[model samples]
Target: MTGPVLYGIPNCDTVKRALAWLEDRGIEHRFHDFKKGGVPADRMDYWIAALGWEALLNRQGTTWRKLDDAVKAGVTDAASARAAMTAHVSLIRRPVVEWPSGEITVGFTHDSFKQHTREALM
Candidate 1:
């Protein structure tokens, strides 16, 4: 909660890569595994408030793709999306990081990660 808290399933390729990136850079962080520990509703609420449900939702992922058309269509707004994300944790984007600066980012990108950790690196 203090430094950086990275939330994702460890086995995910993107999550694994992000973890490696953090480790290789010596960036201290706490990892919250969605598989081991279910998504925290409070934190999920915070993420929704900060980043918006659309930003956290992974509609392009296999989970979403595999969902029934009715289920997919049910996710029409924040409340619906939250329900979908909560019901199917995989629907949430990978590596939702809460940075030391209180910035929340969904997903990982090399440049974006570098930018987010610039101060910590400095």
Candidate 2:
């Protein structure tokens, strides 16, 4: 089977760390750089359905912090969240992993990733 698709900004520190972790474990993945390629609104909507707006949006990032108050206030809904994510790609959480089997996960932790990889490999 093909590897998972890992979406995030290449230069993001968290994404770098996640990539390194995956490499160390010999987990195959394809990287999609949000800054260069841009995320589609439809894909964002799908993720939102699976992960919810709160999980998909990276509120801790500088891009989120710099968002206009109006935009911030409007981000409660999927449409508004998609707009925000489109306007500031960095606000979408880093290292969003979509497995070949159609499982979608956000962010990365070594332990959680290991479990997911084990399940996927099985």
lDDT of 1 at 28: 85
lDDT string, candidate 2, 1-122, tens digits: 47778999888888898899888878888898888889976778889899888888888878888888887888888778878888888889878988777899888888868877888878
Residue 12 accuracy (lDDT) in model 1: 90
lDDT of candidates 1 onward, in order:
0.89, 0.85
TM-score of 1: 0.94
Provide the lDDT at 39 for model 2. Answer: 95
Which whole-number lDDT from 0 to 100 does residue 20 have in model 2?
A: 93
- Candidate 2: where is the Cα deviation over 4 Å? none
Q: What is the alpha-carbon lDDT for the whole of candidate 2?
A: 0.85
For residues 4-122, what per-residue lDDT tens digits would candidate 1 score against the true structure?
78999988999999999999988888999988899999999999999999999997889999999999888888899999998899999999999988888888899989998896556
TM-score of every candidate? 0.94, 0.91
Which candidate ranks first by lDDT, i.e. highest?
A: 1
